[model samples]
Target: MTDFDTDVPPDATPHVCEHCGRPFARERYLALHRGLDHAAALSDDERAAYETAHDAETDDLRRFRLLALAGVVALYFGFLLTYAVVT
Candidate 1:
């Protein structure tokens, strides 16, 4: 293999930061990094992309929390029902 190939890992991130040269597995991560670490240096397009990614991540987190809450509620009711039947 070539020297360049040896430097990169087999599962290296495909998305790379333009300013800092950091690698990310996804474009969203790179956008977030750029926005947080290099905010003043970002162009209009980059800033927009970062906003979109941040919004998406926020929405996803909200959904996850809702799902977890629903799961806990369901388990609590199920256990109560089981105890009622046994007693």
Candidate 2:
């Protein structure tokens, strides 16, 4: 239906999930497919562990982003501090 479909290679259309061997149009769709379709099959303990691990990874990423932002701000102000002293 799309105008550029013929222009793109056939292999570029579908994204496959290695875990569930399912095809999706996008990576986010594949992730949603696995999380929704495949997750119900996991045991209660497995689901709990998965949720906990996801939470830990999210927390770690948040901390890393905040720290990086802080470092950038510090560096920017440190440059300004030197510039102010020089001028």
lDDT tens readout by residue for model 1, 29-56:
8899899999999999999999999999
Candidate 2: regions farther than 4 A off: 1-37
Q: Best by TM-score, which number? A: 1
lDDT of 2 by residue, 6-87 (tens): 2334668776655556556665454545556779676675556556656666788899999999999999999999999999
- How well does model 1 score by local distance difference test? 0.84
For candidate 2, report its TM-score.
Answer: 0.55
Positional deviation of residue 46's Cα in model 1 after best superposition, in angstroms: 0.6
- Give candidate 1 misplaced runs (Cα > 4 Å): 1-13
User: What does the lDDT read for residue 48 in candidate 1?
Assistant: 100
Error of 1 at 38 (Å): 1.3
lDDT of each: 0.84, 0.66
Q: Which candidate is the best by lDDT?
A: 1
Count steric clashes of candidate 1: 0
